[model samples]
Target: MSSQETEVLVVGAGQAGVAMSQHLTERGIPHLVLERDRIAERWRTGRWDSLVANGPAWHDRFPGLEFDDVEPNAFAPKERVADYFEAYAKKYNAPIRTGVEVTSVRRKDGESGFRVETSDGTVNARYVVAATGPFQKPVIPAVVPDTQGLAQIHSSAYHNPQQLPDGAVLVVGAGSSGVQIAEELQRSGRQVFLSVGPHDRPPRQYRGKDFCWWLGVLGKWEMAAPPKGAEHVTIAVSGANGGHTVDFRALAAAGITLVGRTNSFNNGTMHFASDLGRNIAAGDANYLSVLDEADLYIARNGLDFPEEPEARVLGDNPACVTKPLLELDLGAAGVTSIVWATGFAVDYSWLQVDDAIDAEGRPRHQRGVSTEPGIYFLGLPWQSRRGSSFIWGVWHDAGYVADQITIQRGYAAHVADVPLRQAATSAQSHTELSERIAVTQGA
Candidate 1:
């Protein structure tokens, strides 16, 4: 119905888009951020009712907007976190248009910019950022369509255990969502049979510190790549809350049936591969490896952090006997619901540009910088490094991505010459920090 033009257009006003806008606004960059829903819509609607940030509020703060006035150690719930984003969008009065869904993003042939077709209007921008989300569409197995007579609900739509039919529930997937939801369901007195998969079962508290603290201090957050061969092991923290270890052992001990990975559901029967023992063992090994890495980092960095009692291991759980399940007769089990905790899928079907997408169907980019002249992506897991998808991680990427847009437009460098990661990684940065600390102590 109407038209608009801007130097840059950012899609999705979530953590990534808001962070990007924060930097762009500081530089006097002309940009418009469009959100199909409210800011942090995913957090508001997609997560469970009791969902809290898996990490501490202190570590999850966006740059310049640290967790002030909020409990630093408390794991902020979904509403609190969503409100934080809303407050952020309002604090700076970010140039965000909510409820504006972009239907298509295509290169403007003969023109250098892109044409963004939105529910409100069309926008022409020199730079287009695909910051929609890392968690977009929920990916359910194809065989799930054969789940006749069973109430099928993906974790995205699952708010509480009461919402499902009162009977045994099968949580399909062993990632954070699946584990957390299954825990909740079982706690709600529902028999939750968890379909196990390759998962990272790191301890929530390691050496008397939150796992995140170890990750932060050890610079483990900087290493942002999916676990080798387990790309499904997202760079997610271990717990549903910022406290306690959550593993198959823990879940299994809590009276939940731990089954093998789901193969398919056909003819009223759900089939599984007998990799339960193997997966559990592998997860346990990876967990130890992770702790060892953190331990190594602490020792090598000469940190004098105190250690607590030894953390518990899944091996000790007697209920964690991983016998493979080949088939689950949904009718026989009287399973009234199947919660698909099978993570989300990214869709770039709207990104209408050739050579812009990589062979893996991901935006061809290195550290948020796209292969295309003016196209960029933000909020991607591992966009810059391991922490890219996390709240703190977005700030670093937003600065870099915004600077790339502004600098190309011949705007004065409003962004810092040295990026956050570089500053953290550079020897000069360490020297500067040491000097500052020394001077402060001297003063």
Candidate 2:
């Protein structure tokens, strides 16, 4: 097979890879980015048709580049986000090879580099940056039984509401994807049964400012991951309808059936955990906590942001939470489709480096530096901070990783020069000894 060489090989030409390339280019690092598909492929293909960015444009972009012709406060469409990344890559002239899939990456035998096996050819690189962001694989719960005739798809594959079979839909999971799809289906005049789960209900806007603005001012974006046991609680904020807060009660009032955690499907009956009320209560508490923190921060900093009373008010408990429906007959409800917005799984099976992956299949790294030299990871959730996985945040993290790579290179060069330095010193001592011997003979 054909072989190519580069100082660095960045796998996956999405935002993370492109960002890393930009930083590496700034450092004059000769790197090649390999992508299985087009640049920003996920944003182009893996999202629902109506999906918009979860954060506002101003807060979610890389440095020195702004969303052209898009309002700062407005959430750009997924297509626009993809276009932005493509434009950014073009502007920097990132060395990206499209449709090149790296099948495996391993240490080169008896060498100080890596051998990357790709579909097109083999690449030898001194350093490899695994820039494949999270969401490598879509995961559907095992609880989803194999039922014939019920069209089920992960949110990644979902396009528009019209794509599903004409019937009531059961959306499992209440994260951003689940909630957004549920809301869209409901608005499309389809009965949506949303399985409510543990989630944070942060308002889209507060006090005439976008929620992202609040998070930025509060320094919440830079905060570490949520405390253990609450890591599963995803933020339920959406950028649809010019952006708005996601309220379960309001959704219930709007005709979407709010259900508890989907437990299992057995014998044509869908069982749900009796935690609807508790789940809703938890989300409400999370919502209030943000508002309270914002209020406290405003007062402490003497900021003039006004209070939003409507945001703080907890609406009436939906009947689903009050008198919970523990079970639902899918057939009776005419539920012909199931959208598993259950999120994605992390898979790094292709990385064959030793001591680089943990037992749980997560990258073993310190702020993106792997235990194995010359190997690194990028765009992992909380890789350095909570913002590590975000769009703009990934850019910052990539710069840091690039800095680490530069430091490592300098160190390696210094170590490589040690033997030469020692050899020169030995030669000078031998020459002095020879001259002394000759002087002794002459005397």
Candidate 3:
């Protein structure tokens, strides 16, 4: 087995991984990026054909590249964005080893470094950055009762309406993915039923102004300054994780029957929340209200508006009707295709670090540094700022982590002969000390 070495080893070659690699390379850090497949495989294979970014094209660009000659708010197709990433990698001359899958990463016994075992060979590194994004795993609800004779698919597997079975399609989960899939299915002349969940709504254009305008003005995409000591602020509403602003009202207006939360399925009947309309209406109201507040904030901040005669409060908005959660008889409704657009989960089984992750399976790190000394995470939702996981938000986190890694590697070089067991023990003691200080400060 051939053995190779680098200062840092970055896993994955998506937007986040590529961005991190770029930063590391620019800093003159000797690092190697290992990717399990070709670059941008998710965008090429996982996304639907008609799928465009929910946000603007300007927001989607990496650190140094522009999308097209068009305005920033233009919506670039998925393939175009993938092409941008590929170009970014070539431009930077990033040291990426493609088609190399990392099997395990364990601490080297006699050295303060890691032994990364891959299908091709092994790599010894001082630090490892896991840039594998959150969307690695697709989450399908366990509560969804299995049907005897129905085709079921997760949103990841769904490409277009043509893949759906010829019958009424019941889409579970009304998040952005669910709503988009449901809308597409409905447009295809399929009898589509959408299950309403906790979601937000926004018009395609808010008072003739693009929604991205407000987001930019409000500093929603700005990297938040890290909190002092251990004090951290919780996340407020933003574009990335809060919910998607889909034209649900338009979908409802178009004759799509909105259902409630999926409770269970029995005898081919899907049960849903009785107050489905109420939930949808409430969600719409809250989102509009937030946008209204955002508009006010923008005006107060003396920002120029794209739309003249800025939008005013419509009026006292009525709470949407919520019918009692009910069940849909799938067999009676002739439901053939069930698309579970529920959401995604993060899976790190391939990652060998166990102590650094939390109960929710998220990396237990302040910003990106894990409890372990040399392991780090990037591309997590709200990882640093409101939009850390967003295309625009990732650069700051990537740069910060890269700098920290470089600094730490400098310190490690002076003590490279330290034994692994001693280093692990010291790391644990430091973590404990930090926790104690945090608790003391809180008290």
Candidate 4:
């Protein structure tokens, strides 16, 4: 196999890796990015066909580039997002090698750098940034039993309603992905059952502003952690059909049955927790809390946004919640498919650097700086803040990680004059908008 050398080697050419390359390039740092597939491979192949970005184009995009040709307020489709990443990489001429998968990364023996082994060849680099992102492995709960003929798929593998087998479909998990998939399947004439779980229900728009805009302005996105009792609650909002709220009651009204969380699958029967009412109530409380926060922000600043009366309405309980089903026999219910909208897990088996990761195989870092020198991580959820996993947030994190690399490489003077975060701020189209985002890094 062929071998190569570089100052820095970045794995995964997704948003995080590309963003790292962009920052490294800005600093005149010599780096090469490797990807197992095409640029933005996850967006191209891992998402559902009807999926769109959760955040508006204006808010969730890289600095120096708006989503290409898409409206600022609109949530670009999956394809558009992938296209935008490809375009962004091209604009900077990022040194990316697609289809080259990094199989192992370890510190070189008696050396200060890493010996990177890839599917194609090997790479020796002084620094390595593992930008594989948060969604490395899709996880289905172990409680899901093996069925003889029932079809099941993780949300990442789901393309559209037609991708599943015919007949009723049971969707487990009530996060953004699960609710969106359930709604889509329901709309496509499939009887859908959505398992309710701890979730945050924020309206897509309140008053005259999108929920994302509210989150940013209210400093919600910059929060270090989720609120108390909501550590695992997923945000249940969507950017489909221009944008809309993901109200469980509203979804139930539209013919999607809402059930409690799937507890287990035994003897060909699916068990459910008796927390449907409690879960919905918790989500409703969160929904109200967001509106209350937004209201408080507007009140304090005396903003001129109008009140949205309809958003305050909490309708009657849905049939499923009122008459909760303790157990479900999929065969009898005619449930032919099960879509697991459960989230993902990280895989760091390839990274053999000591002290870089914890006992649980999770990266041990403050921001993106790992405990191990010359090693770094990017694109982790809450890596710096609540927004770290976001598009723009990842860009900022990449900048921070790049700065750390520059400092370690004895090139501090090269970036001493201007910080990359400030540079990105200066490159923004709107000064007010750029100023609103909390800075994740400094020189």
Candidate 5:
């Protein structure tokens, strides 16, 4: 196979990879971006027609481009976002090798480089950026047993509700994707059933402030070191307004029925959690409480005011009435389609890196730097700040990592930064010493 060389090799050409490529180009660094398919293929092919960004347009912009339109704070459609990404790639002249499937990435021992073998050829690069997003794989639960008669499709495969067969369809998972799919199917003259699960709920706006405003105020978007006790916890909470919110009241207003969480499936019927409504109610309340606390904190801090609070009605409490998992008896309900809005998973089998990822399948990185030297990760949830994984957040992280890359290159005479393992130990010692000093002073 032909061989090539570059300063860096980016594995995916989505938002993160494109953002990194922009930074490298601006810095005059030589980098090659390899993509398995055309850029923004996921956004183009993997989403539904009615899907809009869960966050506002401002939250969806990349490094140099702004997603400004006449409607401020509006949800941008998937196609529009994909178009923007295409424009971004063209604008930056990103060195993208499309249709090149990367089969394996093997790091060379005793050398600060990696061999990336792709369908086209092999390339050795000093650094590798795994810009392949967390949503590389579609997650379908193993408990969802085989259905010989029922026509089932994951949300990834579903483009429109019209693709489903005739009859009542059961949608498993109550996340944003699931809710939207169920709503769309119901609107398409099909009887739709949903399986509830642990989900977050926040008002579209609170006191004249958008939900993102509250997240910004509560340090949820702040880039601080991970909390002492919450090492495993990721700070970035999904913005409530951007995705589908099951306004139970609105659903009731529209005459749509609610159902319980799916536990298992057997004999063509799905089992559900007994306390599904109670769990959903508790989840909604808990999210609201968090937002309320955030609002209170913002007010106390004397942040700038936008306007008077807007009048909005919270959804009805799901606790008053509980519904068992509405098993769509396909024959009786005439169910035609079942859309699995179950979330996604990350697959790193192609990359030959060891002990670099955690048990949860998340890369073990302090701030984008993985355990293996020269193997860095960006655009992960809570990678740097709360927004690092976001379109806006990637820029800042990219800049830092770019700087780190420059320093490591010895192009600039700055010392290479210490690894996360060393940094964490130092931080722990500093905290211990501070506690001792406080005790002595108090005594």
Candidate 6:
């Protein structure tokens, strides 16, 4: 096997990975980004055909590059997002090795770095950044029994309404994915049965502004955790068509059947928990909590904004909160397809360093810093803040990792951001950015 060495090693070529590579490159860090597939592989293969980014195009962009000539508020579809990464990588000439999947990450023998084993060969680096964002593996519940014949697919595999078998679809998990897919199927004239669960149902827009705007104004993006003893609730608002909430109430209003959480499937009957109304109410309540935070922020700032109508709090025609359907006969309901949008599971099984993971096998890190030096993580949900896993947020954490990697590599400064002076005369002052970066990397 071939052996190579670099200053830093980045695994995965998604949004976070690419961003991390760019930042490290700028700082003159010698790094190699190993991607399991093409750039933005998950965006290319794991999302639906009609799936648009949950946020606007402008908000999804990386640090240096804005969507040139593209509408800022436009909803970027999967391919658009993928192409942006490809362009960004090429623009920066990122040191990426596509189709090279990393198999193991272990401490180098008698060294203070990591040895990365990939399909092609091995690499040694002073620092390692695991930038594989969230949505690593689709998590289908164990209770979802093996369907006898119904075609079942995870939300990641779902492409469009036409891809499913021509029959009513049962979409388990009422999160953004579940709600979006159900809405798509419903619009395609297919009956959709959505399973309700605990979720946040923040309005797409509030006070004539995008919901995220309020979050930013309230400094919620920098929030890494909730108050002690308070539950950490994941926000599930959808941003289709600029900003639209795809909650249970929205689905019910769209004629999608709202069912309770699936408990078990036995003898052709799938039992459900009787918590539909409670779940919807919980979502509304969580949304209210967010609004409350925003409200406090507004009062603290003393900003006067018009309030939206009470009915518009959820939707134009919010679905009346209904009782849970405790049981559903799959055959009788004509549910021919089941799409589990239960979200993804985080896994770091390839990490071989002791103490790298906690008892739960999750990365044992604080703000991306691992217990083991030189090993860091990026793109984890709430890794640093509530927005850590989001496109708008991953770049922040990536920049931090880049600085750490640079410092760890014994660069000229804490980071490779030092200006590279070309031995110019004393009269020459204020070196240009291009020259500085060029000479810095060359050094």
What does the lDDT come to for candidate 3? 0.71
Candidate 3 lDDT by residue in tens digits, 307-380: 53433333332232333337777778788988887667787776676667777786788778889889999887
As a TM-score, model 3 comes out at 0.83
User: For each candidate, what is the lDDT?
Assistant: 0.77, 0.86, 0.71, 0.87, 0.69, 0.77
lDDT of 2: 0.86
Residue-by-residue lDDT tens digits, candidate 5, 332-413: 6565556777767787777787756777777877777788777888777778776776677777787767656654554222
Off by over 4 Å in 4: 411-443
RMSD of each: 7.3, 8.8, 7.2, 5.7, 8.1, 5.6
TM-score-sorted candidate list, best first: 2, 4, 1, 6, 3, 5
- Count of backbone collisions in candidate 1: 1
Model 2 misplaced stretches (Cα beyond 4 Å): 417-443
Q: Which stretches of candidate 3 lie over 4 Å from their true place?
A: 69-71, 145-147, 202-204, 207-209, 222-245, 301-325, 416-443
How well is each residue in 61-114 modelled by candidate 2, as lDDT tens digits?
988789987899999999999999999999999999999899999998987889
Give the deviation of candidate 6 from the true structure as CA RMSD. 5.6
lDDT of 4 by residue, 97-186 (tens): 998999999999986689999999999998999999989999988876564577889999999988888999999998889988998999
RMSD of 2: 8.8
Against the true structure, candidate 4 has what lDDT?
0.87
Off by over 4 Å in 6: 226-232, 292-307, 310-320, 410-443
Q: What TM-score against the true fold does each predicted structure earn?
A: 0.87, 0.92, 0.83, 0.91, 0.81, 0.87
User: Which tens-of-lDDT digit does each residue in 279-362 have in candidate 6?
Assistant: 777777767877777667767888787765562355432443444577888889898999998888777888888887888768
lDDT of 6 at 417: 50
